[model samples]
Target: MDDLARLVATEDVRRVMARYVYSADHHRWDDLAALFLPDAPFIASTVDGSVQARMTGRDDIAGQLKARNHPDSVLVHHLFSSEIDFESEDSATGVWAMEDIVTRPAGEPAGMHGYGHYRVRFTRLDGRWLIAELRITRLRLDWTY
Candidate 1:
């Protein structure tokens, strides 16, 4: 890819990542699922290396996220320092520093705040960039009771 093309692709990938965070925090499950490929794989794990969940396909991803971030929950995700590397005209990989705060309803546990990084693979499908693979690794977590 040309310099300009590569730059544009990088920016597009960044936008996709931003959209993913926005949709997830806002409980926009359908929009969140649309940010990924139909058969994409998603894995989330804790800092200590325990697997939180593993999901394949957009439908499953959306369902799982909905279950985790329910109606009585409030989530906020902040992404920073994203580095995107283009491997080809249609493919790239990126890592992002992230922090998230989640709060449940009054009767539930107080809340959770976590810091992490997201490693992802992006694919340009049908002229649009989409997440093909994603794994979130936590660096730290704090809970309030």
Candidate 2:
């Protein structure tokens, strides 16, 4: 692809990443699920390299996220410094610096603040960019009770 096409594709992928954060934080489960490939792999791990959750397929991924951010929970995700590289016209990879805060109900534990990097693979399916693989590696996590 030409420079212009590549730029456009990169922007599209960035938009999708932003949408992922927005949808999750807003509890838009259906919208978030639509951002991934049908059978995508989603893995999340901590700073010590311990896996937190490993899920395959959009439905499972969405369900897991929803469960974490329930009705009495507030989730905020911030992403920055994204590095996206195109592998082909329809495929790319990216790594983004991220931070998230989760606040639970008053009766429960306070919640957690985390910093991480999200490594992801993107594929264009049916003319829309979708996440094919996602791995989140946390750099730090702090909890409050």
Candidate 3:
């Protein structure tokens, strides 16, 4: 790809990643459906085997995530130091260093603080960038009760 084209694709992929974290943090589960391809898969696991899951299809991805998260919990995700590589005009791959804190309101159960990396694949379809596959692996995950 040309320099300008690569630049634009990079920015577009960044936007998609931003939207993903924003949607997840805000519990806007439905909005996340639009950020990924219909048949894409979402996978997450921890280094110590605390968690492991896989879901496919946009609707299933959103539905399963909504089910897993507590309604009263607050989630904040910080993504830093992303390395994105363009494989073609329509495809790219990225790894983002990430941290997240999940807490609940008063009287709620415990929460967790996590450090992770998101390895993702991106595809451009219909003039829009979307997450084609995402695999999240946590290097450190701490739970409080």
Candidate 4:
């Protein structure tokens, strides 16, 4: 791998990661679907024994995100970091630890706080990189009853 190739691959990985966080936080379901391949697989789990379940396909991803962003949940902040791993020039995998804090209307209980980790897989197709799989494992969760 040459220096230029490495730089380009790194940049592509970074851009895809940024898009994943931004689209999820902003509730841009359509954009979020675009972050992955047409048949990407996703599974999100929480420590509270609640599982968001595994979903496949772009349409399914969009549907899941739409259902996740509720009216009471005013905001979603997904902080990703500590990325580690790249298998090849066209394929790689990494980890991203995230913190999501949600806010709600006054009087009502505020939204939950979640800490989780994502195992991300990337694949390049036609010069563009996209997520192939995203498996989320929750470490901690705090929310009102």
Q: State in Å the error of residue 43, model 3.
A: 0.4
Per-residue lDDT, model 4, residue 127, is: 90
Cα lDDT tens digits, model 1, 59-89, are 9999998877658788999999998899999
What's each prediction's TM-score?
0.95, 0.95, 0.93, 0.84
Candidate 3, which segments miss by more than 4 Å at Cα? 49-51, 105-109
Q: What would the TM-score be for candidate 2 when compared with the true structure?
A: 0.95
TM-score, predicted candidate 3 vs. hidden true structure: 0.93
Q: Rate the local accuracy (lDDT) of all candidates.
A: 0.91, 0.91, 0.90, 0.80
RMSD of 1: 1.2
Model 3, 1-145: lDDT tens digits are 9999999899899989999999999999989877999999999898875557898989999899898788888899999999999999999999999998988776766788989899999999989999999988999989866
Pairs that clash in candidate 2: none
lDDT of 4: 0.80
Worst 10 residues of 4 by lDDT: 71-80
Residue 44 lDDT, candidate 1, scale 0-100: 89
Q: After superposition, how far is residue 114 of candidate 2 from its true place, in Å?
A: 0.5
Point out where model 2 deviates above 4 Å: none
lDDT of predicted model 3: 0.90
